[model samples]
Target: MLRLAWLFVAAWVVPALAAPPDDPLRSPAWPYMAERYFAGQTVRFDAAVRVLMPGAAEDPLAVPVYVDAGALADVREILVFADLNPITTILRYEPGELARPSIGFRFKVQQATPLRAAARTGDGVWHLGGAWLNAGGGGCTTPSQASGSGLWKDRFGEIDARLWPRADGLRRLRLQLIHPMDTGLAGGIPAFYLETLALQDSDGRTLARLQTFEPVAENPLLSFDLRGRGAVSIRGRDTQANRFAGTVAP
Candidate 1:
């Protein structure tokens, strides 16, 4: 009876695995969306922020922020500061945002916060995108999942790379490794992700440098768009000296 039940479960789950990826509604992260946004909330998109404070601080109180238009065409609801919080709240839509919608403004955050942009498409569907950032080190100073000293000694020379193809001959490349990017003594967990990513062309001219952290979602999927006509090499070294390397061409 146990064996029969196990087979029954596999028979149901196997077909689901064979389906295509990119089904946003069925994704593992999908549930988090509904938990974040709900009915009657107006969705905000492509917002610009202006910070009215003493030197671009991330504090919620002092920062003055809002969308550009007062009454959007089809706006159903509006949600502000859906990213980092003990303070995120939904600004619901009575009708919806403008028909040909776009928004921009300035705001302050005490630290880098994750920002979510959602649109209720013409087909009555919801689309979502997000950006994660730090107002400062409060999030970066969290504890790490691995140990210092030991992971450091063994992680030397470890490297991993992934190349994702994009339209218009652009390539998105990410390279990461298993090292405790320790900040020399402070030693925070999630705080220990890489602080900078430096990429170079085959000839060694620098291409790009990215600011990041462990909250960057494990193994560090560093992505950037680049144009090149030859061999490209990528390498990353964290504050803790954890290094990774890879090469790809398009």
Candidate 2:
């Protein structure tokens, strides 16, 4: 009967449509590998479009992210996002009077997965850039010596100014801090670190703010340029609100 034929077609189509494609984040193509190898993985997408650029199987880059600012006339800050690690979002850099429209930094990738960098323009619309990694290592799990105990009890770090000129009177500064920036808990050490750092000038302004973590090396170093010049100061704190302050002379 015609009804029976239609039911058969419906059954076949329904079964086919019910099954979903395998997800690359959790269960990658390399099935022979261990599952923990792909654990804590994440990728970036907007409206279901994956933004990461896939590299050749033989490529050696650990993290790959495309940064494009040609779409906008003015840009604000480039926000980097990665969901696979303990800390999903990586870094955010504020351009702040810099002549360059695009920039990039070398960060340690924690896994073989997708990474994203998005630019927020003056108009407030966010644009995206992304890359993929082929190896796995938890940067957050790395160790630092100064994280805990009474050994560094009074050894807090310091910085001079939040923003200054780059010696050419270009309004740049060298901001410093004193902290162990512990990668994470290992043994008895605490798993504390600075997740973000920023500097604002005399006009109640922000010159630059960096996204930071244990993988950012010890005693984090950040230098940036601002617009105005006059008795500049800096205020920075880690996830624990441990403060690092400094001033620059005009």
Candidate 3:
């Protein structure tokens, strides 16, 4: 009877601790995240959707991630998030006509976590890609660089952004926005960051849009790929309602 009981308990524990079936990355948080975020939605772990990052983060507050879903067709949206972060949602990008299915940005992390990207194609299927990071942790609670000094006031809304023509016939737009991007988790600090940035064509038609959250690092360095050869403009507003705009000629 004792041996039988131990076998029963072992069977239950093994299944409970195992990763969900068909998870290639084998993240321990994938099961909970599946129902919490992608509940009732069709999600697939696809290799064509690539999420690239360094093996270890030198600065937890500025871990860089680059996602390229160019191999997937008719991608409608792409989302990047950390599974175990206090603020999970990092970025939401919709590249309509102005860009390809590739983007790069940096975000903060509280601990070693699974970083994933979900790219939804027009067929109503969501494809996934991700990688795990080895980090030192404590990135979300640190005071921002801008908060450590009054120097942020001198260059709060400055934008160093431009569009460059690539040899592969794709126009790449590289932009950097100067903001503290405080998560407000630190002592006596407030949460502030850029809310939304829109890319528009010469006719003022919105080509793509990116929505960011507090997990993004200070002075966001962003990149996007364009498929057309027309002039485009970037417009955005921060949490304080400060406006920023810049134009790029293709």
The lDDT leader among the candidates is 3
User: What lDDT does each candidate get?
Assistant: 0.43, 0.52, 0.88
Clashing pairs in 2: 64-131, 65-130, 157-178, 160-247, 164-171, 164-172, 164-173, 165-171, 165-172
Per-model C-alpha RMSD: 20.8, 8.6, 5.4
State every prediction's TM-score relative to the real structure: 0.38, 0.56, 0.89
For candidate 2, give the lDDT: 0.52
lDDT of 1 by residue, 88-167 (tens): 43222121110112232223243545545454545454444445534553332333335533565565446566656567
lDDT minimum window of 10 residues, candidate 1: 91-100
The reply for model 1, stretches above 4 Å from the true place, is 1-143, 148-153, 181-191, 241-246
Q: Candidate 3 lDDT (Cα, whole model)?
A: 0.88
Ranking by lDDT: 3, 2, 1
lDDT of 3 by residue, 1-250 (tens): 9999999999999756553446676777778888676766788889898989998889998988899999999999998888888888899999896579899999998998889899999988889998888889999999998999998889987888888889988888989998999997999998999999999988777788999999999999999988776788889998889899988775
Candidate number achieving the greatest TM-score relative to the actual structure: 3
> Candidate 2 lDDT, tens digit per residue, 1-250?
9999999999999746544334344433323221222232222233222243445223221233334443455767766655455555556666666323343333444565555555666765555455555554654554554654566657666553344356554664555565676655346667566666655566767666666654444555554545566766666678787776776776
Task: Say which prediction, candidate 1 or candidate 2, comes out ahead on lDDT.
Answer: 2
Lowest summed lDDT across 10 adjacent residues in model 2 is found at 32-41
